[model samples]
Target: MHGRIRTWGPGALVLLPTVLLLGYFVYGLIAWTFNTSLTDKHNARPVPTNHVGFENYVNLFGEERFLNSLKNLGVLTVAFIVGTLIFGLIWALLLEKGVPGEGIFRSVFLFPMAVSMIASGVVWGWLLNPSQGDDARGLNRLFSILHLNFLENPWWTGGSRWTTMASIALPAVWQLSGYIMALFLAGFRGIPPELREAARVDGASEFKLYRYVLFPQLSPIALSALIILGHMSLKLFDLIYAITGPNQFRTEVPSVYMWNTLLRSDMAKAAAIAIVLLAVVAVLVIPYVAYTVRQENEE
Candidate 1:
């Protein structure tokens, strides 16, 4: 025991502050938020008092707006993940093939990631503006000039709810596709060139080589990206807020709902919504973390 303490004591001391800070600020806040969700607190008194159990959560589920937010989240998550992965993989494959201006193109693809989500939202909001006739602007104006007026229509402001959510997802995909491309490109580069040669020598066509060998090797990278994107989608807020603002129910998500609920002094309901978001993120992330840890241990 003495020998063990002598070896580890200094390291433990050095990590103590960081551990305490995480304990208080991270897990501690999660516990506090969960506790608040179980109470009957309101804006006038944001503190928890009457223990109402899961009443707030029950009521949260009953709310039409909350249900709609969940549906919007589902639509956004599917569109964002599928669109990003497809586009990212395509970019990675094109880059791997040694296209001309490869270095410049890679930098151009990644530039959007340098811009903030709010900025992308503002820009896309204008591009997708649905105005027409004399009032037309953005894409509508461009389409009018090109005489392809049929392509222009109301984006998030006036559209089918699912389509609106998917439209909102486009900006997110544009922002993150480059990062995903880098992940995929790194995965491709990490595989030994000999694997490609072996597959080619075995009479495999180029498409078959990628389909049978390279793509399978990228499963780990894909899973990691899926988890990351899934969690981000579940907690999405800022971009939607910047584009649709708080009133656009078609684009409303749980985070936005929580903000609106909190503003209305419904503290318990907002806490409940927050806890729901946290639970969803945990559901997506915990499995990936476990899979990663198990793989590390096996290796």
Candidate 2:
């Protein structure tokens, strides 16, 4: 007991300041937000006598823009997750087959993730710009060259909300799929070679082997990836803001809406929206995390 305590002493002392700082920064911010959400106070003026009890939440639910933003968030989250997972799995499989120039391919895929989302958004925005030229020197040009004229619609300028949403989702997928692929590749590599060889020797088809043998092993990693991607989709802000600006109805995600409300002096509404967003993520993520932990313990 004495030796163990001595061994931990230095580590505990080192971690004390870090723990305190994290609590002050993270827990402190959350508590402050909770307090502000309950009040009807503006930045310049304090509403000392006007303590609104969930009035802001009621008002927030009544707003059409808030409702629309929530809908968009749902759409974005689902599409982003599905798209990234599918693409990531495909990328991982391709890489696993020992392709030539594997390093270059991996780097190319991950380079987008290394770039800031804001910068990627700006670049994508330019590439999708509708008013470029008659040749439509962006997405339009590429579509025209490929004889896919239907896809040449002015994604940025046109009033087609779905088109705009798809455009935004494309860049997000490009940036995120690489990270997902890395996770899946690591999971795939951890599988025993003997198991795969034995499956093949037993006349199991490649597809069957992957489905029955490999997928179950990957569940924990996949679940973790899902939780992370879901949280990211829930609080997505930088990309949307950079690509569509804060005021645009077509690209207003929940986070963007919350920002607008907070910056525009609707503190109560902002806080209400923020709380709702947090609750949504918690509902989706908490169960999965608990399940993962339980599975880990069982294993």
Candidate 3:
């Protein structure tokens, strides 16, 4: 016992504060939110003594607005993840070939990520403004100037709700694609040159080399990026809110809906939405975390 304490005592003491803080602020709040969701509490009855037991969740899933939000979330996730991965991979590929001014290009690509999502959303909000005719501005004006009028459309305010949500994902893709590029680029560089040489010696072409040799090794990095982006999509809020505002059902996600619900003092409903979002993020993240831990242990 004395020997174990001597070895582990300082590390345990150092970790104690962080463990307590995380337990209370993070996990504890999650528990409190879950408890609140199991209640009949709102502005009318601020006290949550009435334990409803998942009634809020049941009603939330049945609501048309919430269902639409989930649909929108699905559309945004698919678009955002696909767009970012494709673009990031392209950028990384170009950089990996030793392009001129690689450092400058990499920084330029990554600069958008340094800007906050809200700022990017505000700028993109103007760029993707649905207005046309005499009131045309932003991309509409640019389209007119370039005579690319065919490219101009109502963007996120389009009639099709799923299309609108997918369009809203463009800004998110722009902001995060660079980070994905960095991930892929790091993965590419971490690969041993011997692997490439050996593949070439085996008569593999450039395309075949990447398709069979490089990409397979990058699978772990891609999976990690997918999980990270998946959770971000699940909790998406600030960008959508900044672009379309809270009332736009076409682009509304659960996080924005939760905020709006909270504003109306619908505490139970909002907590239910938050818990649902948390559960979704966990579903994406936890599996990846387990896989990572298992890989670490095997190594």
Candidate 4:
């Protein structure tokens, strides 16, 4: 045991500080928040209250706005994940095939990612504005030119909640899909040329080759992408907050809702909502992590 320790001690010592730092910085805060959520303390007020059990959580669930925010989050998560993955995969595939002006196309697609989320939101908001007449800009003008003026309703109007939700999601996809494409492209490029050559030699059609040969190998990459995309969707805030104002019910997400709660001096309820959001992410990720660990052990 002493000999084994001597051999591994140097590496272990090197990692100790990093592990400690992560625990202190990340895990410690999570623990603190968890404890806070169990209390009925209002941070904005003078006196800190005592433990209140799950009353905050009950209150959170009882609120219609909170429920609506959760529903909005669910819709955004599904739409963003599907849209980004499909669009990213297609972009990656095209780039891998050496399409015309591939470099330019890649730059154009990725440029959105380089901009700040707030900037992206601002740009997209302008582009989606639904005002009409000579002063019409963005989608409104294009629709008017095509005599499709019916599509020019104010995107942020309270009456069209679904349209507003979709508008926010579109910008999110546009900004994030490029990053997803980069990940897919990296995975695609790592594939051995010999495998493609062999498949071609066996007279495999392009579609069949991709469906049977390529996709199976891309599982790990896909899983990685899902994990990243899932986390982003779960914690989504900046774009939604920027594009739609804080009070906008139509575009409310968990993060924005949490912010609103905090602003409204509902710290305990905000903490409860945050804990719920954390649990949701854990429920989604923990299984995948456990499966990966099992596979690694089996290997």
Candidate 5:
């Protein structure tokens, strides 16, 4: 016992404080937020120290803004995830053709991924500005020049609910599709050349080869992208805030709602929003984590 303790003691001593800090600061913070959500501790509540027990959640769900934000999130999540995956898969497949300037093309595609979403939002917000009068700018100018003025519409601001959400998704897809492309590309390249040759040897056509062999191999990559992008879309904030500036337009998402709620000192409602968002993220993440662990175990 003494010898074993001596051997492992230093590592335990090093890990203990860090683990305790994380448990308190991170997990404890989450627990506190959950507790806060159960209270009526802000704004005009008479007894501020009382636990209201989900009244905040009931009030939050009844709000039109909250419902709209949820709808907007759904739109953004679908558009962003579908667009990124399809475009990314397309880019990956095209690059897998061993085209000339492969490195340059790959770098060009991936460069946007390195750009911050806030920066992307700023640039896209300018480019897709809907104003066509004296403030005619970016794509509106080009559209006017090309006589395609009909295509010029509100980009990320003030539009049909779904339209605005889809507009915001465009920049998101543009920025992150490259990363998804990289993921799929790596998955594609990881497939052995022998598998392709054998498929060909068996009289498999190119489409058949890919449909039967290649796609199944990319399932893990697809799952990873789906989970990553889904969580991101659910938690989207910085980009929307940067571009939209708390306008509460059709593009407003949950994170923006939470921010505005907190600003109004509706602590309980804001915490409820946060907790709901966290639950959503958890719904995505926990499954992914379980799948990953299961994969590792099977391996």
Candidate 6:
């Protein structure tokens, strides 16, 4: 027993630094943020601030901008997820059905996944500029060349609030659809040809086979995509901010809200927002992580 302990102790010592760093820097910071949220911390004040006990939270909820940010988040998240999932599934299915140049198509579709959201947003911002006439740009230019003016609309800057949020999601969907496609493609390939053949022999048509059997088998893949895309969309800040540049009229989300709030010395409000954001993330992530861990343990 003593010898066994000694043997693993060295390895434990080696890993201790990383474990301590994670526990302190990661979790400790989260704990501090939560603590800060419970108080009335202001950058304008001295180093120490007085306890306010959820006043910041109440105030945050009362703010019109914060509420609008929440609404925009919901709009963007749903639009991005559904659009990406459907588009990816369709592309993956087409590729699986034997396209003329499958490898080339796969590479092309996956290329967007390699680009950063910031870069995609910048490019798409240029493409989606809502200006008209002499200053018409982005996809509007394409619409003009193709004589498809009907298809052109104010992408990020024009339209109703919900529509504007959904427009912001378009670039995100385009960027992420390729990743979702890769996920679906892998899921499809992982499915056994023998299983498909058995279904065929059982007199199931192509549509029915996929509708019943293959679709059910791909549930895990779909769930994985949902979890990933949901996480990305919920906490999104960089892309939207980079493209829109703090456009208060539209395209604001909680993280950006928090950033602006913190910048203005509203530390308590920012921390409250951060805590709320963490809660949302935890709600999405905890279940998935637990499920994955359980599956691994069972396996």
TM-score of each: 0.96, 0.90, 0.96, 0.90, 0.93, 0.94
Off by over 4 Å in 6: 3-11, 133-135
Between 4 and 5, whose lDDT is larger?
Answer: 5
Per-residue error at 192 for model 1, in Å?
A: 0.3
Instruction: Show pairs that collide, candidate 4.
Output: none
Question: Pairs clashing in candidate 2?
Answer: none
Question: lDDT by residue for model 2 over 1-299, one digit each (tens)?
Answer: 99998999999999999889988997787767766677786554654636788877787789888888888788788888888999998999899787999888888888889989999888888788775345577777888788877777777456555666667788899999999999998999999999999999999999999999999999888988898989998888899888888798877988998888788787766777778887898899889878878888999
Q: Which candidate order results from sorting by lDDT in descending order?
A: 1, 3, 5, 6, 4, 2
Poorest 10 consecutive residues of model 6 by lDDT? 129-138
TM-score of candidate 3 against the unseen true structure: 0.96
Write model 1 residue lDDT over 35-65, tens digit each, in one string: 9899888767645479899999898899999
Candidate 5, which ten residues in sequence have the lowest lDDT sum? 40-49
Cα lDDT of model 4 overall?
0.85
Q: Rate the local accuracy (lDDT) of all candidates.
A: 0.90, 0.83, 0.90, 0.85, 0.89, 0.88
Our model 6 lands, by Cα RMSD against the true structure, at 1.8
State the RMSD for candidate 5: 2.2
The candidate with the higher TM-score, 3 or 6, is: 3
lDDT of 6 by residue, 136-178 (tens): 7878878877888777788877788777988888888888898
Model 3 residue 143 lDDT score: 91
Cα error of candidate 6 at position 180, Å: 0.8
Off by over 4 Å in 2: 1-15, 46-49, 131-135, 156-162
Cα error, residue 82 of model 2, in Å, equals 0.9
